[model samples]
Target: MKPIDPRLLRYARATRLFLTAVVALGAVGAGLLVAQAMLIAEVVVGAFQHSMAAAELRTPLLLLVAVACGRALVGWLTELAAH
Candidate 1:
């Protein structure tokens, strides 16, 4: 086949970047899900074993959720920026 144009190569680059961002989003979502589960488990376990009070659990759980949301927002921003 003949050589492709530079513009075509740029399309390929954008497509690759889009795909990379998609994969990163998936990986980040999965990772956040796992981490959230682990953190909740840790909180419960610590509360039971170490006798942590109610207020102590609330802040950490809220923080974990906030961080997960932040990760999601980052993924979205990355995709938008790539475009």
Candidate 2:
């Protein structure tokens, strides 16, 4: 048995670009998750400490939803790229 060369590995898989995309998306998703967590913490702390109303929190909630949807879209695109 022989070891494959790193450069040739890209040719070995039809989904090489797809795999690359998945990795890139995974990185983006990680950042989004961190942002989401921070947004959640801010909302919670603000609500508790400043007595912020739900209406005031609406924008942050929407931003969170957008981040989640962006992550989902990335996953979907990766899946599409695979085939």
Candidate 3:
């Protein structure tokens, strides 16, 4: 295999920070999505299988909302960074 060119590294330096930001934001978004899905599943299971009261489901429901909001914020950040 050929070695990397030094000139390419020099040009890439400028984008390295932006690339890092995008990667970080993407990771955060993915985590939030997972949390949101898990929360939804929990809420469904608790309400249906376990027949949990609304009061008992409150925490998970609130967490789901927070995770959704976090995902939206991350998406906005990613878009801003890309531009």
TM-score of each: 0.55, 0.73, 0.84
Instruction: Point to the candidate with the largest TM-score.
Output: 3
Q: How many steric clashes does model 1 contain?
A: 0
How much is the lDDT of residue 14 in candidate 3?
79
What lDDT would each prediction earn against the true structure? Answer: 0.79, 0.82, 0.94
The global Cα lDDT (0 to 1) of model 1 is: 0.79
Worst 10 residues of 2 by lDDT: 9-18
Off by over 4 Å in 1: 1-13, 48-50, 71-83
Instruction: Write one digit per residue (lDDT tens) for candidate 2, span 1-83.
Output: 98988878766676666778878877887898898898888889878998999899898888888988987887787677665
Q: Rank the candidates by lDDT, best first.
A: 3, 2, 1
After best superposition, candidate 3 residue 29: deviation in angstroms? 0.9
Candidate 2 Cα lDDT to native: 0.82
Tens-digit lDDT string for candidate 1 (1-83): 98889999888886986778777877776777788788888788879998999787887788688867877786676668566
Model 2: CA > 4 A from native: 1-13
Top lDDT model: 3
- Model 3's lDDT to the true fold? 0.94
TM-score for model 1? 0.55
